[model samples]
Target: MLIGEVARRSGVSTRMLRHYDSLGLVRPTGRTVGGYREYSEEDIRRIFHVESLRSLGLSLRQISRALADPAFAPASLVGDLIRRTEERLKREQELLDRLRAVDASAPFDWRGVLRIVELLHGLGSPDAARRQQTVLTPAEDAPVPAEVLAEAVLAEADPYVAGALRWALARAGADGVASLAAGVRSEHAEIRRRAVRALAELPGDEATAALADALGDSDPAVHRHAALALGARGTTTAVPTLVRMIVEGTNDVEAAEVLGTLAADPERTDRLMSALAAELAAPTADSAVRIRLAQALAEMPATSAHGLLRQLAHDEDRAVAAIASALVRAAEQRPQG
Candidate 1:
């Protein structure tokens, strides 16, 4: 059969068939005198097998490798895919946890809209934002002009009102981020904090940087919210600012919480361990900060972190010593290289 006929029979696009051929995943059995491709029953079966593996979320590379290796069992391939899917699911769960944490800190009155905004922010995709907006703004309400509701929602401090504001913002697209950014400069600190937090969810480099700036806001609550927003987005640029706050600032507790999540990235393990070591070296470092940093380091699996944690087990503070001991015990359970 020709490529078009094979595509129609297999339900895979002609372009994809050609791509599969290029990858040596599936190839036609023969070619006509004029160079037109001709596939046989065997080719069709190979195409179906490729389609089945693709549907299971195996990448072309994985499928290619599996096809090349006679020793690769189907069950083993499926188990590998399942393991990758589970890892992705775990990452999604972590993002959800960060979103929930941000939602809890948002002003209660605007919790509903903030919750949606939090979810959208966590998604980090335009398509997801649009889908979420559709669910929050029902079809029946589509005809209602946004201006009519914006005034009412923004004027009140109720959670419902805040929710409405967030819904309207999602519907408004990029304008929402701009308007919210302006709102962050409001005279009211609470309003500024809430607006900043909402804007942090919006997509843009400017919005991310603005959230980082908000970390230095005089209000500890606002600063904390900024830290959470930056952490949720996985903005590594804000890590230096957060590290300083946790290591040397007054709001050490809140800063440490945010840094713990940020440092969960294995790439940042060295930086986190180094920072913790520096804090521990300071004789004047607050005991609470030392304990928090030690706890954060313990959660990481880096070898350097394990050494630091073992040393922390001997701290004078009983609570810090106990946490250190627990970390050492946890690390010991892992098989040695």
Candidate 2:
């Protein structure tokens, strides 16, 4: 077939076919009597193969190596193409995300768009201090989006920068809650921990609910932090977690103090006392555990804890007995409620 016929049938543009010849990807198998390029059936087949490889995102140079070198492994080249395509896709996605974030602000003009892009770049900067400044004192005219702050908060590892991100995120309000909440469920332990910690600072029912969900996290650190934050928020749901913390001797003192403050509630009095008294009676309550529980019990109101204190005052464990005795003595001097 002549070059024109091959171009028509194979859908390979004549210019591109000439370029392919220059690169030796596919050369015409013969020359016509008039000296025009002519392609044999095999040459046409090679042209189709080159087009097929190009469809797989193979570069012209790679296609040349693939078609000419039998020793060239398609598997390795395809793997490389897959990786490069994935990288390109990732960049495109990031760019699309930036544009969407800018659009989300409903920017008034080019300047507004520019402000958001600049803020995003600052947040994503390699310098932690630059990120901190971007969040800590964002331009007054260019409001930072909550999702942006939440993303930065989840990714920041610098202690100071992370603190700033959380502070900014809280100011952004409940809008950031969903993003932070997603971070709470992340499989990466560090991200999950940071997510919950940031969520803990954010006020709103959404953040509180997220913290409550985190109470069941498999990581002890995550659950403990969530429980402490929840306890501070006066969420009754945190009671069981705080009790567990005391028993495990992890931040037992703080847990005990929060529990003490919680027990001041008349409704929680009975449940709180019962929880401590049961732990004291548990066979698993070793001396150290018993001592921590005894100290926690002392935090309860004198009226609520008096009977439990009396029982522990003469306990077989001297340290436990001593803590109960000292608190009982102190309770005696106070006026009855």
TM-score of each: 0.49, 0.91
Listed per model in order, the count of residue pairs whose N, CA or C atoms clash below 3 Å is 2, 0
Tens digit per residue, CA lDDT, model 1, 122-238: 333345444335435543312223332222233335554456556655565444454456555667786776676566556677677768777767776676677767876887665
- Enumerate residue pairs that collide in model 2: none
lDDT of 2 at 81: 85
Total clashing pairs in model 1: 2
Runs of candidate 2 with Cα error greater than 4 angstroms are 323-337
Instruction: Provide the lowest-lDDT 10-residue window in model 2.
Output: 290-299
Candidate 2, after superposition: displacement of residue 272 in Å? 0.8
Model 1 scores a TM of 0.49
lDDT of each: 0.66, 0.88
Best by TM-score: 2
Error of 1 at 264 (Å): 4.7
Q: Model 1, 293: alpha-carbon shift in Å?
A: 1.7
* Residue-level lDDT tens digits of model 2 in 100-122: 78887888989988999999999
